[model samples]
Target: MPTWDNVPKGQMTAAVLTNPGYSADPSDCFTYSTDYPRPTLPSPEWVLCRVHAAGLNRAELRGRTGAAPFIGEFIIFQKEYREEPPKILGEEFVGEVVEAGSASGFTEGEKVTGFLNGGGKAYDGAYAEFSLSHRRRLYRLPATTKLPWNVLAAVPMSMYTAWGALNLAAGLGERRKKDNKPVVVLIHGATSSVGVWGLLVAKDAGATVIATTRNTEKIEKLKAAGADHVVLEDDIDTEVLKIAPDGVDIVVELVGPDHIARCANLCARRGTAVLVGPLNKNWSAGKFEPFYIPPTRNVSFFTMTNSGPGSEDADVDHPTVEALLSDVVHKIETGVYPQEVVVDKTFALRDIGKAHQYCEENRAVGKVVVTVP
Candidate 1:
C-alpha cells in the first residue's frame, strides 16, 4: 500500500467485530479487536480518509454479531453465496478527507461524512481512526453542520434509509405544496436510530409524526426528537386512532411481520409502509410484503434494495442523496434535529465486542458508538 501523501503513519485504531457463524452471546464479547490495520493508503487506485468519528448503526451490529458479512461473495463475485466472516463494519460515518487522490476538490483535513456503499454488506466500513473511502462515493459533510464526531457518523445508514423509504420508494417526498397536507406519518420502533430520523423528516416535511417505542421510557425522548405523539408498540392501533382518526399517510416500519397487520390497519388509502428495518439482529435483514395489503387500502411496502444491486446502486440516485444529506444538515444546524439525542452509548475501540452486545440486546435508544482513546 502506498503511503497517504500528507497523512501521518500509525494513526489507525478501530473496533473490529469478529464474525463467528452463529448468534453472539454476551460471553462472546470477551474479546474485542483494536488498532488492527486501518485501510491502507495508495496513489491512483484509491484515496484514504482518516475517520474522526463513526456512528454506530444497527447494520453494524448485524454484521458483527453473526447477523451478516460485511463483504460476502454474493456481492463482490457476482454469484450465489452464504454469509462470510466480519471485518471492521459500520454503515454510517463522519470523517475528514486526509488524503486526496489524482482529482482534487476535497483537501486534507476537511471534515465530511457519508454512508457506506452497497448497504455496507460485504463492504469494508468505517469504525476506526483511519479508513479508506472511494473518492467517488465520499462527499463533503456539509458546510453548515456542526455535529460531534459520533453524531456525524450516525446520520448515513439509518437516516438515509428512512428518507429513501418514505419519500423516494414509498412516493411520499414527491408531494408539492398544494398536495402537501398535515398528513400523518406512523413511525414504528421510534427509538431505533432510523426511527429517530423518520420523526425528524416527517415533521420537517409538514406531516404529523406518530412514533412507537417498545420501552415507555423512550416515548419522552421520541417526543423530544419531534414526534407529534409517542405510543408503545403494543398500543399502536389505539394511539394512532386516537391521535389521527383519518389514519396514517405513511408508516416507517422498523419492527417487521410482527407488526405488519397493525401497519396496514393504520394506513390511509394509498398510504405506504416503508418497512425495511427489522429490530432483531437474528432475522434476515429486509422489508417483506406486509402480511397483507388490501386493494382498497393501496398500501405499498419499500425497503431500499429496490434501487439496484451492491454498493454501486445508491449512486444512481445522486439527487436523492444530495437532497437527503442537505435536508439533514439543515435540520442539524437549526436544531430541528439535534445529534445529542442520537447516541445511546460509547466505548473505546478495545471494547468492540461489548458494543456489539449493546446493539444485539436491542435495547438501545439510538446509536452505540465505539471511539478510540
Candidate 2:
C-alpha cells in the first residue's frame, strides 16, 4: 500500500474511505486512512487531487444525526460500469491536482475541488489528505486565494448549493433582466453557509435582500453580510411584513417546507421560492384559501438536489465556488479571509463525536474544523 509520507512534494498521496455501512451516525459511517493502493490510476476520467481540505454538509448526515456520511443510490453493476463497494465518502472538497489526465489542466498540481458523484463509493475522497476526481467534477483553485484546511474543505459543497438554487434552480432573476435593478430577494436561514452565499449573490445582483434567522445574536453578523433586513425565521408576519408590505420577488429557503406557506404568502406577483433544504421533516403547512392565481400571485416553487441533471455543474459553473477557493488561498497567502477568533475550543480528528455533538448543540459559531495531524 502507498503512503503520503513516501510521496514527493508535487507528488500525490494515496487515500481511502473505509468499510461503509448503513448507520444513523457518522461515527459508524466513515473511516479515514492513508493505507491504500493507487488503483489503476486514471488513464482518463481521473485526476489525482492533492487535498488541502474538505467541507462537511448537513446533507452528509442523511437524516442520521451525523452518524453516517451519505452514499448515493446503489446500482447493481453490469457490463456498462465496474463497481466497487465500501469506498471513500465525500462530495465537495478543495485540493490541488498533483497529476493530470490525457486531456488538459483541470489537473497537474493545480489547487482545486468540486462536487463528487462516485466519491465515497466507487471513488476516493478527501478525508485521507489526497483523493481522485473525474476531470468534469473539479475546478482549479485560484492562485490568489489561500484556504485554511477547514474553510477550504467546507466551502465547495455549501457555496455550490447556493449557486445552483439561487441562479439556476429557480432562475432568481431570469425574467427581471429588463429592470434596471436586480431581483428583490428573501433568504431564509441567513447564517447558514449556503444561505450566506445566497444572500451574497442576491446582494451582488443588486437586490434589496432580506434574510431570516431564529438567533437574535447573529443579527449583526447577518447585517454585516449584506442582508438588508434580518428577521427571525420563526416569526414571519411582523418582520417580513415590515420589510415588504406587498411581497418579495425571490425566496431562497433552507429551513424546509415548514415555512412554505409563509414563503408563498410573501411571494410577489411572479416570484419564485427555491427549496434547497430537507423537506421530509414535519412540514405540514395546512391548506391555502385560494387554489387559483390570476390577479393576485403567480409564484413558482421548485426542489433541487445536488444529484440529477446539471447538478454536476456546481463544480464547474459556480462563480462563487471559484471565489471561495481563491479567497481561501489568498487568505492563506496574503491573510485576508477574516480571522474571527478560534473560540475557546479545538479538537483532534479522534474526537469527531465530540465535535459533532458540540456543533449540533449550536453552542458556538465561526467554523468548526477538525485538525487531523
On TM-score, the leading prediction is 1
TM-scores, one per candidate:
0.79, 0.70
Q: Residue by residue across 1-373, what tens digits does model 1's lDDT show?
A: 1123434356366655553434546335334445465555544535577776666665555555454433321222233223643356665567777777666445787676645543344445676666666554566666756656666666766777677777776666664433555777888887877787777777877888888878877777777777888888778778788887767778888876456666777877777766565675334324546346766454544443322356554532445565667777777767777766656687666666666677766667776776654
**lDDT (0 to 1) per candidate:** 0.63, 0.55
Over 4 Å off, model 1: 1-11, 18-35, 41-45, 69-82, 103-107, 117-123, 143-145, 175-181, 281-291, 299-323
* Regions more than 4 Å wrong, model 2: 1-43, 63-87, 103-105, 118-124, 147-149, 170-183, 279-351, 363-373
- Compared with the true structure, model 1 gives a TM-score of 0.79
Q: For model 2, state the Cα shift of residue 115 in Å.
A: 1.3
